[model samples]
Target: MKSIVFTFSFVVLFTQLAMAQQSNEEQNLIKLSLDKWQWMADKDVEKLSQLFDEKSKFVHMSGTWKKGEELDIIKTGRIWYKKVTVKDTAVELFGNTAIVWNRITLDAVVREQVAVNEFTVTEVYQKNGQDWKLLALTFSSVRDTHQIKH
Candidate 1:
């Protein structure tokens, strides 16, 4: 009876430790996603390129493009991200993939026209070896009727 009880306790402890580790990993991914947003706002094309997967796709309200094309647009000042303020974020993990939803207020210049808007951004990241690369990013404009309290 004592051996059985000890075995059960060991299993419970092991499961708890595993869950803690997974939670830490999820938190790290959340931070990475936020940092990516900062990199975009700063126009750090090199870092952005490194984080983006080769086959990544990006969708904006105006259009959609692949990784290289999106990088080129940022590099050439065609679409400049001036600022990004994240209002709320949620992250979900499915095996080795993570999906993040961010409600943000973005200030940017598109085709030399400055615009500021609120959007709900969806970012998908996949774990590759020891690193996580962004696989997709899609932005949808938030309706003006819904106000986000600062």
Candidate 2:
């Protein structure tokens, strides 16, 4: 009876430790996603390029693009991200893949026209050996007529 009880306790402790580790990983991924947003706003192409996979895909309201094309657009001021305010974020991990959903408010300039928009953005990251590389990013515009009280 004592052995059985000890085994159960050990299993419970192990499960808790595993859960804590997984939570930490998820939190780290969330921080990485936020950093990517900031990098975009700042037009930090070097950092962005490092984060994005060579074959990464990007889907925006305007159109879909490959990594190089998107980077070029940012580099040339075609789509300048002025600010990004993340309202909410959720991250899920599946094996080596991490998926993140961010509800964000963006202030940007597209073709020299100022644009303020809300978007539900989905980002997917794949683990490459020990590193996480962004595999895909998709943005859907949110049309909200209500203003925030705060």
Candidate 3:
């Protein structure tokens, strides 16, 4: 009974360690997703769209749900992000899927009025073949501010 318990503990510890390593790898993939977000803020729609899967979904802070063709959001001009900075990020992995949570501070002019918003964002990514693509994203706006200094 004692030997069995000890073996089970070791197995659990080893499994946890292995999972942590995989999570780290997923975090690295999430770094790429962050790069894509930066490009979106810069209005590089083409590049940003490439990072997402074809059937990806987005739930905007404004309570709008978008499905497929992320480029449409850029082309329609319903939203625009000029500068975005991500902070306090956490990445978790579940096999071929990962979730990235972060606080995003954005500088933008919505409806021709310049405003700053601090938002909490979560992006889900799935491994597609050798590459990881964004599967879904959801964000909530914390506040609208007058300006963002840096």
Candidate 4:
């Protein structure tokens, strides 16, 4: 009766706490994603070069390119990532690999023309030694109503 109800409540509380708590690795990965976004907006190619794997791929609507080309684009401001408003973010970890999905509204300058777009950006990362390197980043245009289902 009362004893059983008390035990059930304790169990439920414990389970909810466990579910709400995230591991350190998961927190670090999410932070990395957020930092990457800021670095992109800042055009910080020096830090970006270190974060991006040598064979990393960047896929955009117009074309796909490797790390060097992507760095060059950022450095030269051929397409400036002026601002990114991240509406939602979700990150999942599988062993040493992590994937981050960000639903964002991006304000950018392309060939001196301003473009505002809503997109879902998928970023894949792999642990390399003590650091996590970005392996791939792909963008998919989506509507404003899109949500990240974690």
Q: Give the TM-score comparing model 2 with the true structure, all chains together.
A: 0.86
Q: lDDT tens string, model 1, 41-103?
A: 778899999899999999998899999999998888798888888888777889999988888
lDDT-better candidate, 3 vs 4? 4
| TM-score of every model versus the real structure | 0.83, 0.86, 0.72, 0.86
lDDT (10s digit) by residue, model 3, range 21-139: 87679668767867877777666777766677878888875555544444666655556777778766777778888887777787776767787878877788898888888888887
TM-score of 4: 0.86
Cα lDDT tens digits, model 2, 2-113, are 9999999999999999999999999889889989878888889999999999999999988999999989988888999889888878888999999988888889999899
Candidate 1 stretches with Cα past 4 Å from truth are: 1-19, 144-150
Residue 82 lDDT (model 4):
92
Residue 146's lDDT in candidate 1: 47
Q: TM-score: which is higher, 1 or 3? A: 1
Residue 44 in model 3: lDDT = 76
- Each prediction's whole-model lDDT (CA): 0.88, 0.88, 0.73, 0.92
Cα deviation of 140 in candidate 3 (Å)? 1.5
Candidate 3 TM-score versus the reference: 0.72
Candidate 3, residue 141: Cα displacement in angstroms equals 2.5
